[model samples]
Target: MLPISALSGAPIVGRATVASIRLRLPLPEQLPPAVRDHIEAHAGSQNRQYLYVPSPVIADQDASAPLCAFVSIDYASDAETELVEVSRGKMLKSFLKQNFSRDADGDQILAALFHMVEHLPCYLLRYSDVVAAAQALETAFANGDAPSLMMPVLPAVENVELGWGDSEPDQPLVRRAQATVVDLEGEAFGVSADQRNIVHLDKGALRVLGLFDVRTREREVVDILSAAFPTVDAAQIENDVSGAVRRFRRAGLLVAT
Candidate 1:
C-alpha cells in the first residue's frame, strides 16, 4: 500500500542577498545664530587656554624683546628629571662663581643664573673651566695687553691639545684645557698638544689659514694677505702675517714641514 501526502500546495521562495550602501552627509553652509555664537565662544575659550603669552617679569621693555624663555620638560622617569635638576644646580653654581657677586640675594642670583644658562656665553662655563680664563681675559682687557683687534693669519696645525696646570698667587691664572675641541657659537677651538694650552681662532684667522697649501711658500703668506686686504698697505700686511706665524709657532699650533 502507498502513503498519500496532504496539504502540499505551499509556495517555495528563493533566498536573496541584500547589498549595503553608505551615504556621506555634506556640512551645512550656515548654522543657526545661537549655535554659531556658541561655537565661536568655545573657540575663544580654547585660545585663551593655549595662547603663548610672554612673561611679564620685565617693566618698560619692548614687547618684541624676549627677556625670559620657557622650555618644556620631557623625561621618561622621575630619576631623569632629578638628574637634570642636579646638573642645572651645578651649572648655576659654576656660573655664579665666575660671573655674579657672592653677596647677591637669592632672587637676584637665581635670575642672573637663569639668564647665563640661557644665553650664548653660557657655553664657556658649560664646556670649559672658564673661571680662571674669564678673569685673565678681563685683566688683559684692562691692562691693554689684549690681542690685536685686527685679524691675524692662521697656520695649519696637525693637532690641538688641552691641558690644566696649578695656578700660583703671583702668576696669571689660565684655564685648564681638556682633551677635546670646543665649539663656541660656531667657532672651532682646540688646545695645543705641545703647549697643552687652548687655542682660539677667529673668523679672520680661519680665512687666512684656508689659503695655506703645500705648494704655498711661507713667505707667500703676505701675498695671500694682499689678496685678502687690497686696501691695506703691503708692508703692514706682511708684518701682521709674520707676527701671526711666530705666535702660532710659539703656541706649537703650527709646525715647519
Candidate 2:
C-alpha cells in the first residue's frame, strides 16, 4: 500500500486505496484552552512528528508579504520513524547536483535537474556504476584526491552524441559541416553534464559524438543537422538541435556569450 502522511514531495501519480477512517476529533476553534495547552505540552517529544500551522501571527510590520509555510524535521530514535521523516520531504539532494554544493537553492536545483531528465534522454546511473564510482571516490579521498564521495560520470543520452575531435574544414567543394556541442545553455533549464552523469544515455550519445566533428554557434547547429540529414524538415531538425545545444552548453562545451 502507498504511504500516507501530511505532505508530499515530487508528484504522486495516484491516491491510496486503503479504507478511510474517520475520527471524532475536536475542531481547532472548538478545542478548549486546557486541551490546547495539554496538546502543546506533549508536542515535539516523539519521532516522525509534524506541526502544520494553519495561520501564524506576524509581529513585523511587513504584513503585505504572503504567508509562508515552514517544514521541520525532528530526530527519530527508530528506523521506521526516520524513514517516515525522510519520505515526508522531497529528496532534493538525490536529484540535484547543485544540492551537493553551496550557492544554489534546493528547489531550483531540483527543478533544473527534473527538467533535464524529463525532456532529455538522460539515464539514471546503475547500481554497479554507482558502486564502482563510490569505490573510486573513496580511494581518491584516501590518497588526498579530496575527502568526499564525489563520483562524476558523463553518461550519454539517446540519439545524442558527445565527444571531442577535429571538425571538417569549411570548403566550397566539400560542403562538409562538422557539428559539435560547443555551448548548450539556451533556455532557463537544460540538460547539462551533471544531468548526463545522473542519467546514462551513453551508447547513443557516443554514436552522435562520432558523427559530430566540432561545436559552434546555435545558428551553425542547423548547418550540421542539414548536412547530416539533407531531406529532414527544418522543424524536425530544430527540435534535436535545441536539445543538443542545451546538453552541450550544460557540459561547459558551449560558453555563454
Candidate 3:
C-alpha cells in the first residue's frame, strides 16, 4: 500500500513506522512535542492502554482525569472483538469524534478503524495513524485554522512483513498504480510502493508517468503522447516515456512487471 505520510501536514516521509495514539481529553488543543514524544516512545506495544498526563499532571502518573489524557494504539489486523469504544463514561464518544474525525458527522475517523481494530470497552480517542495525524491536529493550531474531521492515516509500517507481492502474470508497468499524488505548496509529491520512501516528480515526469498503466502497453503510451502533441517528434516522445518510466520504477513510484 502507498504511504500517507506524504499527505500529512508535517509530511516527513522517510524510514519511519506507523503507529496509533488515542487522546482522552475534555477539549481539543495543541499537543506539545514533549507530550507527543513521550507518548510515542513509552506507549506499550502489546496494545495495552497507558495513562497520559500532560505537563501539569505528568508527574502524578495515573489515569486520573479532569486534566490528563489516556494514550493507546490500534494495529491493523488486531484480534479484538467488538468495534465499540470502552470507557468509564459513554459520553466520552464525542472526544473520539473531534480528536480523530472521520466525516462531517465527526465519526468518520473511526469509520475506517471499524474494519480493523478490536473491541475496547473504555473511554478513549483513538488514532488510526497518530504519527502523521498528530501533526495534522497540530497543523490547525499552528496555522490558526478551524478544526475539521479526518481519519488522517499513515502507512502502518509493521515490524512483520504482513504479506508478499501479488501473483499476477506479466502485468504491464503502471504509473502511480498503488500510489497517491498530492500538492505540497504547488509541488507534486507521492509515496513509493514499499511505503518507506517519499518521491517528488517534476511536471514533465509526472505528465509522462500519467500516461502509463497496467492496462496500457508502453508503445500505446508513446503513441498517445505522440498524438497528443503532434508537433513533437515521435523519438522525443519515446525517450520521455522511457526516462519517466525508468525514474519512476527506480523510486518505486512505477510498478515493474
Q: Per-candidate RMSD vs. true structure?
A: 32.1, 17.6, 17.7
- TM-scores, all candidates, are 0.30, 0.25, 0.34
lDDT of each: 0.36, 0.34, 0.44
- Once fitted onto the true fold, the runs of candidate 3 whose alpha carbons sit more than 4 angstroms away are 1-171, 193-195
**Model 3 CA lDDT for position 176:** 50
Give every collision pair in model 1.
Answer: 161-191, 163-177
Query: What lDDT tens digits, residue by residue, belong to model 3 across residues 119-214?
Result: 213322335443445554354236543223233354554332211243122346665546655443345645554344344567777676666645
Q: Rank the candidates by TM-score, best first.
A: 3, 1, 2
Model 2, position 89: C-alpha lDDT score: 17
Candidate number of the best lDDT: 3
RMSD of 1: 32.1
Candidate 1 lDDT over 1-257, as tens digits, reads 01111111221111222211111122123335653454444432223224222222332321222212112222221221211122333344444454434454343333333333334122121112223333544443454421112111222334433112221212221222222334434544433532233345555554444444232444566677798789999888776655554444444444443
TM-score: the better of candidates 1 and 2: 1
Worst 10 residues of 1 by lDDT: 1-10
